[model samples]
Target: MHIFDYSFLDNGLLPAALTNLTANIYALRSASGLRREANPKIFTELEQVARVQSVKSSNAIEGIITSDERIAAIVNQSSAPLNHDEAEIAGYRDALNTIHTNFKDLDFRQADILSLHAQLLAFSGNDDGGKYKQNDNLILEIDSAGKRRIRFRPVPAQETAEAMEQLELAYMEARGNANINQLLLIPCVILDFLCIHPFRDGNGRMSRLLSLLLLYKKGFLAGKYISFEEQINLYQQLYYTALQESSRGWHENTSDYAPFMKNFLSMLYMCYKELDKRFAILHGKKVTKKARIEATLENSLTPLSKRDICAILPDVSPTTVEAVLGAMVKAGKIRRVGQGRATRYIRT
Candidate 1:
């Protein structure tokens, strides 16, 4: 049996770099809390934007996708799923909604985990939704030539139940320990759950869901206003590379958790920074809608789409945003990249 122990987190095992990263994340989290308290209404718009982005990006990560309009409709429950992909997207929306609404009462217990998986596949009507895999599964990678190779072997089916039980217990114990930082313990638990691969499907999505749940429960509420999953989707290569690096030597319990831990922390840090930036653009001394739009594009770490600009400046109408963007492009102050749905603007 593979044993799960997070006692290392209480010790000096984390690298200096990770420690500093966590400190920065903590400071940002605190600042974000203050900002939210100052004006909760401003974040209401951000919450709506993040909800759509979270549903889209989390499902998109597993290759489940639909049109952006359809995704927004599904997430908001204004339309029914028209196909298998849409159905899966709806399931994720339901699961994410449950966490965002009820995370205060949720825990890392096996039953709660099972219930979440059930909600995750509620629309698919799959019998395996709330159950563990009855057979072993492999994490696979496909090469360019279409060759499939086993990336990692998860816990055997017979041992999965016990493994999950132990995982829950380990997380509960670590969470209860004041000596442990919940930030560090979160990634370890997620990595272990992935190694277990409790379900035959939806393992990857569940891990992301659990990531938000745990973070929210521990006062890291940045995911609520900024899509943590979107950040991961944007930097997917780094996300997978971190998971691969940390999942090594797992069966015998010698795997290093730092890679995934750092990745997780970095993602949270980005979410907080993003939340701060969005709020700053709205509340800063820009004084005019056009100036705010320009400031948004100027300070953005990534390119901004028209819709993104509208979200950041909810008071600004889309028509105004479009006109301003066109003017900026014509003036050579900003450059437009991609086309149509992929179009985004960046400062030149």
Candidate 2:
């Protein structure tokens, strides 16, 4: 039986690095708030991009995937799911939408969790939705040679209900106390949920959906305009390393929360940073499109791809970006690296 208590967070047990990350996120949150107030309409496009990215990336993390065109159509409800994978993708889109629409009224209760799981698998028609697992499960790791090993043993089905009940109660109790930072609390609760592995299926995806719901409820709105799941998917190896480290000794209540907390906060910080870039690009209507593209490349800390530039400057046409990159490359202001889909540009 695992016990869930986040009161340890109140004692300033967080490492200095995590504390800095949290503080940075808070500062970024304030800036994000001001930007939202200043340009509310600009975020509509971002919201739409994030919605598709969240659905696609979250499912991709679970190995559920479809073509980008089909995913966009599925996410927008413009096309019906044409395969099993697309069906699951549609289900995640709906579940994410439900959280976005109704998070204010939702709680950490078992019923709420079950409902979200049910919605997550509804399109795929998994009967296990909205129900606890009736059998035990294991988290397995496979090596390159295809050998499988038990990564972690989750709570038995017989004990999952009681484990979940205690987890929700503990989370709510801590969440009510002002001493506990909700940012820190969110990861802890999510870690426990993964450890419990309540549903036979959809546990990973449900954790992500609940993460968005909890963050929204707590005023971490970066995920609304930037896909947190996409960030997780991008840094998936780091994500799993953090989860693996934090879940060690989780059953005995000796697990350390710092790894996962740091990773989680870092992802949120990235979302905010990305939002800052998006806002900066959209805010500069005075700059010419070519100038903006040039500046984006020159100022980037890493190389930028045509696709990356297009995403960062969503209002810009790809053809225009392509032309600017070509002119810049010819002028020796920037250089192209790699070729084809692997292509990227950097300041010369």
lDDT of 2 at 323: 97
Q: Write the per-residue lDDT of candidate 1 for residues 236-271, one digit (tens) a residue.
A: 999999999999999988899999999999998988
TM-score of 1: 0.95
lDDT of 2 by residue, 44-119 (tens): 7678878988998899999998766788799889999998899899999999998888999997899999998988
State model 2's lDDT: 0.89
What is the Cα root-mean-square deviation between model 1 and the actual structure?
A: 1.6
Error in Å for residue 280 of model 2: 0.5
Model 2: weakest 10-residue lDDT segment is 299-308
Query: After superposing candidate 1, which stretches have Cα over 4 Å from the reference?
Result: 330-334, 346-348
Candidate 2 ranges beyond 4 A from true positions? 294-314, 325-348
Error of 1 at 150 (Å): 0.9
